[model samples]
Target: MIEQSRLVTPVLGFAGFSGSGKTTLLEAVIPHLKSSGLRVGLMKHSHHDIEPDKPTKDSYRLRYAGSDQLLLATSKRHMLFFEYRDNEERDPQLRECLAQLDHSRLDIVLVEGFRNETLPKIEIHRPSYVKPTLFPHDPHIIAVAYDQKPDALDEFNLPSLDLNQPSDIAGFIKHWLANAPESEKYLAYELKL
Candidate 1:
């Protein structure tokens, strides 16, 4: 499935433990990417439940009343809400959500928080303050975006980037996206979640 996805759109992931600058980096990278004329699609999985609906909205009321899927469309745009009716539906597979993205109109799909998914990912590392690095375990991680270079970096020989410079990271992403398919051979190393 991942091989099939690569033929259509390049998918990259930003993964790190909480407070390791994953979100901080993307906020800057997205604008740089957009300014560079690339149409980017982003998918983020939140550990916390989010409330995008207000209590007074009809969509909220309908969902609250037991609607499974509610799509509110307007002249400008539309929002589709998929309410998970079962325990299995509550958390969806990353591949399923990736398919839903309009890849034909996108240059790349940036995924956040789907660490367990089999894809090329930049592992954001902050050694001085952050927890242990994940690259030692996850082979899906292609490179490191860090605040300080740790000793383990030599062991892995993975490309490293400074976390403080988002532009550099963005450039790294552009380069990685261009060559992501070449790294597919490492897919055999993917750890089963």
Candidate 2:
């Protein structure tokens, strides 16, 4: 039997400060997207150091032997490890990493950070954090997911979504994707531009 190819996969992003509800919103939306017959890919950006290779793992040994990147897969799981030089930044180029996704099988890629990228994003916010609203200044911010009413936010003209309502948020994403321009559809929107 021939394998079915995926339709266009739009990229969505979630951006917020530390302790904001970015992950919380993702936890809610991913399952809903999957249920709707869409295959989803996820990428998270982190500033901290990450050790993808444990000292005893074969992948680690390969990296220690001076391999630049290592790929490990089993029947159930797959992981990639890229060795970095000391003092180098840990994160890889977002676009380059995203390009490695199997677009043939994915309908969407939900990115959890990289606030500066030009993709449409839901800015998770909490009033107590007192951070400036991203939507006011950044046209790329498509919505705001907040935990409480932001009294200082009445002047902004963006959609304000409830952080706790994952179903509703999922509905919003579905609607947006359904209506998005054909040329604009796909994962890594900003990268395309």
Candidate 3:
């Protein structure tokens, strides 16, 4: 059997501070998208240094010995370990990471963080934080999720999703995916109402 690649995978982003339900929303949304028969890919961004391989492990030792990238695989799972070179000046761009995926097989890409990146995002806000809303000047903010009614803001026209009900939020995302222009390829696999 020959494998075919998908033409496009619309990227969706979620951004918020720690403990603001960003991961919670993703946990609910990913299963919903998969149950609808769409192959979903996820990418999480973190500013702190990450160690996927432990220091005492062989992979970690090999990496320290100077391998640029490491591929570890078992019968059921695989992981790619990448080490940045000292002379490397630039970091990978969001699109570059997206391009590295086998998009031909995926229906969508859900990203967490990268708030400053130019991409469509759903901002998760907590009323208690008392922070400024992201939609006022960010055209890329497609929606907002909040625990309570947000104070009136005239600059943004985007809809708001309730953070209390994960199902409702998932439903809203499903609706958006169904109506979005890039949804053509996955329309056939869309969930029936």
Candidate with top lDDT is: 1
Candidate 3, residues 55-103: lDDT per residue as tens digits?
A: 9999889998999878887899778877788875555567656655666
Local distance difference test values of all predictions, in order: 0.79, 0.77, 0.74
By TM-score, highest first, what's the ranking? 2, 1, 3
**Model 3, C-alpha of 47: deviation from truth (Å):** 0.6
Estimate TM-scores for all models: 0.85, 0.85, 0.82
Model 1 over residues 102-190: C-alpha lDDT tens digits?
Answer: 66688888888888778888998888765999889999888899988977988998999888888888888777766656555222222
In candidate 1 the C-alpha lDDT for residue 22 amounts to: 83
**lDDT per residue as tens, model 2, 7-97:** 3468888998888978877998888888888888999988887786679988777888998777899999888776676766656666666
Error of 2 at 80 (Å): 1.5
> By summed lDDT, which 10 consecutive residues of candidate 1 come out lowest?
184-193
Q: Candidate 3: how large is its RMSD?
A: 6.3
Clashing pairs in 2: none
